[model samples]
Structure formats: structure tokens, C-alpha cells
Target: MAKIIPFKAVRPTRDKVTLVASRSYQSYTQAELEARMDYNPFSFLHIVNPGYKYHKDIKGKDRYTLVKNRYLEFKEDGIFIQDEKPSYYIYKIVNRDGLTFSGIIAAAGTEDYQTDVIKKHEDTIEYRENIFKDYLKTVGFNAEPVLLTYPDNKIVANIISEIQKERSEYEFTTTYRDTHYLWKLDDKDSIRTISLEFEKMKTIYIADGHHRSASSVLLAEQLKSENKKHTGNEPYNYFMSFLIPESELKIHEFNRLVKDLNGLSKETFLIKLDAIFRIENRGNQLYEPSKKHHFSMYLDGDFYSLFLRKNNDAFKTALDALDTQILYKKVLEPILGISDLRNDTRIAYSHGKNDMATIKSKVDSGEFAVGFGLVAITVKELKAIADEGLTMPPKSTYIEPKLRSGVTIYEF
Candidate 1:
């Protein structure tokens, strides 16, 4: 069973939240980052990029200490305040595309992660995990919560519907045009009800933030080993998470871009692909894959449809059945001579939100010789993969409702 607890989050004051909240630092280009630090005094960018204040770039432990200092300064200046009582936050985001996501923010048990009650479909890099664990140990807080999705529950849904009827504590729109709203559920009864409802769930799958969660768990274990009087109820025992129903998750597929067709001529390549797929010439009007096993291809200024021949491909596992994996096994490896999906320079990817025309343009520009579009994987497939303890291919899915940092902070 899942054990979720409320936390007294350190959040930006209502007046500064609109300005203080920011997308992850890496998302911004150097110029955009400089512009934010120059014009937006209250932006969370100032805290993370503390070196900006001194007009020099800082890295590693030095930067971590400075980040802690900036965060404390924000608290001293009354830009941030901690809640008087532990509470679960109901956060809602309405994107520019009009997709709305609502979820509960709470401290989820690290024990659940250890026991596999909190599942993951992606692998985390140990080197990056250790780097972030060290940063968290120095800074002593987490601003961005890991996104977790569970099976839909009517009891939880009712609670959210009722809470959303009241006025929110923070309601603001970002320059990116997305509106964010947050409501506090500090009342004892409501908090218990929500927590108990989550306990009934068998498992929750990580929709995003695999590395963050892994790092937090690593930090928790390290701290436990260091303290002789460690207790299970300490702050290190839990990490912040955004829990939503699986139905609310939006998944997109990654389109493949290859630099060349290996040594095979176009005619030979098509012949090899024909063994596993029924190829159709779509004549460049624009094509997109609409179903599992169906794929869209762009080659030599012409668009083609590749439908997996019935019963031609076999799957012994969930990963084996994935469209991306099928493409690799049948076309990329055996025919195109491209392997090592992670380190291979021959392959690149475009998001599903980017349409077929975007992929075609890349191939037409001589940057890539071919492009392949695949149907997005379903939530059922994702859960199945996680249940089997299997990791998906790199960049296999593009998830939505990308979160912001500094909206709420979980401190040790």
C-alpha cells in the first residue's frame, strides 16, 4: 500500500508566485536565461543560477551552497512562506492547447519505491543520480515534485471536484500562456480521506522525473546510513510527488530521423522493409501513423505508409511489442546497420507534437535521409511495461503537463 503524507511546503508568496515560478533551468537557452535574470528579479532562475548575481558562472558544490543562500534570502525577504500546518496541495494547470491537468502534491514514501509499489518504466543514470543526490544533500529541499500516475479512483476524483469549487490560494498565468492554480487542503479530514484513498491503490507508475525520484531515494538511504538514531518518520523517508490518475496522462510518440539508409540502395531498402511491412506510396500529401504496428515514412521526397505484416513480428515481452522496438529490430539493425540507439549518431528524434511536415522538412533539407512516424503508445502499454520491470527505449514517449520549479518546496 502507498503511504502519502502532507508537508508544510515552502511556497512563494501569492503576489510573487506568478513571477517566481519557472520551468526547469535546462529548458531555457543561454540568451533566454540571461534575459530572465536581467529583467525578472523575482524569478526562480535567480535562486538556481546564483552565480548570475556575482556575474560569474559557478559549478558543483560551490553553486549548491550559493543556491541554498539565495533560497534563504528569499525567505528572509518574505518572498516565500511556509505553511503553518502540513497540507496536501491541489495543483491545476491549463496549457495553451487547452489541456487541463489536476493532481495532488504530497510527500510519498521512499519505502514504497523500495518495495516497487511506486513503479518506473525508465532507467536512471547512476552518475547523474549521484550528482543530484549530492546537490539535494547540500540544498536540503526539493522544488519540483516527481509526477506519478495511479489507477483512477472515484473517491479521489470527488475530493478534487469539491475542493476546486472554492477559491484558490494562488492563481496566475505565466508568459508562456499557461495558467496555474493551487488550492490548499489542510483540513484534517480531507487530508486523511485523500491519503487513505491513495493507500487503496495497488501501485503508481512514474510518468516523469525518474532521475529525481531515484536521486532522492539514494539520498535518503545515504542519510539513514549516516545517522545512528534514524527514524522512519524523518523527512528523508519521503520525497515530494504529484499524483494523478492514469487517465489524465497525455502520451506522445517519438518520430525517428536517420541520416542514411546504410549501404543499401533505395530500391533494396524498400525490398528488405517489404518482408515485414506492406509498403504504400502516399505521394507526399502528408501521412501519419494512426494505429499500432502502422508507421509513416519519408524518403527521397516521397511519403510512404508501412503497415506491419500480420503475424510477421512476434513479441515475448511488452518491450518487444513496442513500435519503436519493432522498427529497430526489422529495419534499423538488420537492414540499416544502425545499432546502439543511445550513442548512435545516425539516429535523432522529433516529438509527436511536431507533425509529419516537420519531419519531412528535416529529411528534405538533406540533414536526414529518412524519417519514421509511429503511433503513440497507450497508458495500458506503459503500465504493462512497468509491471514487468522493463524499461522503454530512449525517448520512446513524450509526456505532457511539464511541471514548473519553485511553485512548492519540500524541505528536510
Candidate 2:
């Protein structure tokens, strides 16, 4: 069974939360990052980007040490405080688009990840994992929780609904216009009830933060080997996670862009694609795939819809049925000769949130030879892939709600 336990999170004071909670550092452009750090002293970016204060770019263990120092400074300055009691945090986000996501923030067992109780649908890079593991080991805290989704349960839902009735501990709006509300659930009975409900669940799926989860597990193993008095209940044994219902997950597709046609003429490429797809040209009109196994492509100033030829016996596993997989097998690999999706410079991905206009613009500007739009993968498909112990293609999903860092901190 899955294991989830409450922790006493270190959080920014209610008054400073709006300024302190920030989107992941990479999300910001260099100019935007500079502006925020210049104007907002309380922003968490200062802690992560410690070099900003020194006007130097710090790297490796030096950066890690400086990050730790900045975090301590925040606490000393009274911008952050720790809860005396262990409790589950009920966190809710209502984005500017008016979509809502609610979940519980707690510690999830690394053992659960090891034993497959906490499932994954994406593969993590080893070097990236090790880099983050080293950073976590030095910093000794995780400010960002991995996004996890579980099968919906009435018992857990009812508990969250009841707790939300009262005024939240932290209610603030970000510059993105997203409102965040957090309630502390420390009462013993309610904590027990939430714990019991989660314990009944067999598995949970990772929606985002695969590297964070993998690095946390790696750190736990390292810490266990080093400690002579190792105990299973140590903070290192679990990583922080935000657990929501599967239904609450918002998934978007990643449209593909290719720089060149892999030495093939546009007509020849269409001919090769025609072997697996029944093609139709929708000239000068924007189009997006409407269903599974269907795809929309923009090439040489026209849009085309490609339908998978019926009775193709390719789908043997959950991974095979994915639209991204189908596109790779039918077009990207065989027709275009672009096989390494991760490392290939010939290809790029844009999230569906950008819409077809971005795809058309990029292709029309001579940056890319063609662009392909796919229907978003469904929750059922995602769960099936995880359940089958399979990983999806890279960039297959663009998931939300994109969480904010420094909202809650889990320390070892």
C-alpha cells in the first residue's frame, strides 16, 4: 500500500508568501529573473540563485553552499517559520484561466517508490538525477514537492472539502493572477483519517517532477548507507509530494517541430507517411488532431490531417497506443529519420498551451520544415502506461497546475 505522512513544513510567513513563492527558476527569462530579484527582496529566487547578489555565476558545491546560506538568512530574518505540529497541508490553486486544483502536501515514502507503490510514467536522466541529488544533499531541504496523482476517493475528498470551509492559513495571489490557498490540517482525528485513506490506495502516479522524485530516492539511499544508526522513520526516507485526485490533473500535448526533412523532399516525406496514414490536405487553414491515432501537420505553407490507417496491428502495450508513440513510429523515426527525440537538434517541442498559431509561425518563419499537432493524452492512457510499468516518449505531456517553489519546505 502507498504511504503518506504529514510533516511540519517550513513556510514563508503569511504576509511574505505572495512575494516569496516563485515559479521554478528555469521558467523565468534572464531579464524577468533580474527584475524580480532587483525589486522583490523576499522572492525565493534569491535563495536559489545566490550568485545574483554577488554579480557572479556560481556553480557546483559553491552554489549549493551559498543556496543553503541564503535559506538560513530567510529564516533568521523571520520571513520563514516552521510549524510546531506535524500536519498535512491542503493546497489549492485557481489559475487565471479559472481552472482549480486541490491536493494534500505530505511526505511520500521512498520505499513506496522502490516497491512500485508510487508509479512513474516518464524516465529520468541519470546525470540530471545525480546533479539534483548532490544539490539536495548539500542544501538539506526540498522546497518543491513532486506532483502526484492518485485514484479519487470519497473519504479523502470529503476531508479536504471540510477543512477548506475555514479561513486558510495562507491565501495570496501571484503576479500570474493565480490564487493559492493553504490550510493546515493538524487535528489528530482528521490526520489519522487522511492517512488511513491514503494507506488504502495501492498506487499513485507521478504527474511531474520525475527528476526530483528520483533524486530524493537516491539521496535517501546514500544517507541510509552513511548513518550507523539508520532508522526507517528518518526524514531522508521520504520525499515531499502533493497528492491530488487523477481527475484533477490537466494534461496538454506537446506539438513537434523539425528543422529539416532529414534529406527527403517534402513530396517524398508525404509518400512515406502515406503508407501508414490516410492523408488529407487542408490548405492554408489551421488544424489540430481531434482524436486518437490522428495527427495534424503543417508543411510548406499548408495544413494536413493524417489519419492512422485502420487495422494496423502495432499496439501491443499501453505505450504503443499513445499518440506521441504512434507519431514517432509512423512518421518521425521511419519517414523523417529523426530517432533520438531527447538529444536530436533537428527537433523541438512546443506545448499545446501555445496553440497551432505558434506552430504555424515557427514553421512559416523558416525555422522548421514542418510541425505536427497531436491530441492530448488522456488520464486513462497515462494510468495505463504507469500500471503496465512503461514509460511514455519524452515531451509527451505538458501537465498542470505548475507548482510554485518555496511555498512549503521539507528538510532532512
Candidate 3:
């Protein structure tokens, strides 16, 4: 069984939530980021980018101490205030695309993460875990929500619906054309009951934020080692997360752009792909892959689709069936000679928020030699991969609400 709990969250005063919240740091362009930090003195970005006031000599997360100090400053200024009591928050984000997602924000259990009860399909980088864990320890708070998923259960859905009628603590629509709503479930009996419902489940999968989850675990271990009286149920042992049902979750495409074709001409590459797949001539238009193991590629001023014919029927490997894997097995490895997507300088990824026109324009402007628009993986596939204890290629899925930070803080 999985155990999730409600806690007293430090949150921004309603008046400052708009200014305190922001998209993840990577989501902003250099110019856009500069403007945000410049214009909004209360922005949480200042904490994330504390180097601005510090020194050029100090870099990376070494400035975490400064960020923590700034957090204290916000509390002192009454910009952020801790809740009177423990509560569960209902968060709702409606994107410009007309998709609406709402879930409860609470502390998630990491006790059985290694046992695959709290499942994950992406491997964590040891270096990144150390970095974030150190930051969390210094700040003593969870500023971002770790995205997690659970299987479809009607009881869980009904519990959320029962809480839906209450007035939200924070409710507002943002400039990105997304409506965000948060309700404070302060009734102790209700929060306990909801937590009990979660414990009835056998598994909980992390849909995103492997690094943050790992950091929470590592930090919890340190606290336990330093203090013999430590309780396994402490707040530091868990992290803030928005637990959504797989049925409500949406995985958007993470598109790829290559700087060059590794000296292979377009015709030769097309011919090579034809040997194991069908080359679709969709012409110079947006041709999206419609199903699994299919890919849509825009190259050399034209668009075509590649259908991989290979399949392993005897062993139904979940990760193997991903379209991104099909690209790696067919195009990236044998054709392009780019083995590592992360370290390789040849490739880039665009989030689903970006349109296909950006891909076409980059190729047309001579910035990129080619672009590939991939079909998104299904939520069913994510669960299957996690169930099998398999990892996926980097940037395979882009899940969002791109949650606003500083609205709530789960503290030790």
C-alpha cells in the first residue's frame, strides 16, 4: 500500500500568488527570463536564480544558501505564510488548448520507491540528485510539485469529486490562458480518509520529476542518520506532488531537431529507412505520426513519415514499442551515428507547447538540417513501462500543467 499525507503548507498570500508563480526555469527564453526577473521583484525565479545578486565567482546550486535566505525574506515580508493547520490542496490548470486538469496537492510517500510501489520509468542521474537534495536540505522546503500518477480507481475519483464543491483557497486564470484553481481541504477527517484511500492502492508511479523524488529520499536518509529519534513519517521523508489519475493525465509529444545529418544525404537516408519501413511522402506539410512505431519527419524542405515494421511478439517490451525507440533503433543509431541523446551535440528537443511551425522554420532558416515531429506516448504506455520497471529515452513525453510554484510549500 502507498501512503500519502496532508501537511501544513507555506503558501503565498492570495495577493502575491500571481507574481510568486512562474513556469519552470527552462520554459522561459533568455529574453523572457530576464524580463520576468527584472519586472517582478517577488518572483520565485529570484530564488531559483540567486546568482544574479551574488557573485560571478559562485555558480551552479552553490548559491542555494542565498536562495534559502531569500525564501526567509519572503516570509518575513508576509509574502509567504504557513497554513494554520495541515491540509490537502486541490490544484486545477486549464491550458490554452482547452484541456483542464485538477488534482490534490499533498505529501507523497517514498518509503517503497525502491520496491517499485512508487514506480518510475526514468533513471535518475546521481549528480543531479545530489544537487537538488543539497538544495532541498538548505531550503528546508519543497518549492515544486513532483508529478505522479496512479491507476484508475473509481473510489479515488469519487473522493476528489466530493471535495470539488468546496471553495478553493486559490483560484485564478493565468495569462497563458490556463485556469488554475486550488482548494484547501482542512477538515482532518476528510484528509485522513483521502490518505487512507491512497494507501489501498498497490502502486504509485512518478510521471515526472525523478530528480526531486530521489533527492527527497536521499535527504530523508541524511536526517535519519543524524538523528536517532527520527520518525519515518516525517515531512522530509516525502515531497510535494500532484497525484492525478492516469485517465486524467495527458502525455504530449517531445519533438526532435537535428543540427545536421552526420554527412548523410537526404536521398541515401530515405533509401536506408525504406529497407525496414515504409517512407511516407506527406509533402511540405505538418505530418504527424498517427500511431505507435510511426514517425513524421520534416527534412530538406519536405515532410515524410517512416513506419517501422519490426516487432518483438514473443516478448512484449513496453519501452521497445515507443516511437522514440523506433527512431533510435532505425535513424539515430545506424544512420545518424548519434548514440547518446543527452551528451550528443547534434540533437535538441522542443516541448509540446511549441508548434510544428517552429520546427519547419528552424530547418528553413538553416539553423537545423532536419526536424522530426513524434506522436505522443499514451498514459497506458507510461503505466506499462513503469509496471515492467523499464526506463524510457530522454524527453519522450512532455506532461504538463507546468505547475506554478510558491503557491504551497511542504516543509520539514
Per-residue alpha-carbon lDDT of candidate 3 for residues 1-412, written as tens digits (9 for 90 to 100): 8888888999989878888888787778877877888899899888777776653434556687888888898899999999898888878787888887878899987676755679888888999899888888888999888988887777757767777787767777677878787888888787777788888889988988899899998998888899888878777778899888887788888999999888878888778878867787888778777777677788888888877765422236977777787777677878888899888988999876676778888889998998888888888888888888898888888986578877788887
Best by TM-score: 2
* lDDT computed for candidate 1: 0.93
Error of model 3, residue 73, in angstroms: 1.1
Over 47-142, each residue of candidate 2 has an lDDT whose tens digit, in order, gives 999999999999999999999999999999999999999999999999999999999999999999999999999999999999999999999999
- lDDT preference between candidates 1 and 2, better one: 2
Kindly report which residue pairs in candidate 2 clash with one another. none
Model 1 lDDT-worst window of ten:
310-319
Which wins on lDDT, candidate 2 or candidate 3? Answer: 2
Root-mean-square deviation per candidate: 1.1, 0.8, 2.0
lDDT of 1 by residue, 261-345 (tens): 8978999999988989999999967999899999999999999999999877678999899898899888888888888888799
Clashes of each: 0, 0, 0
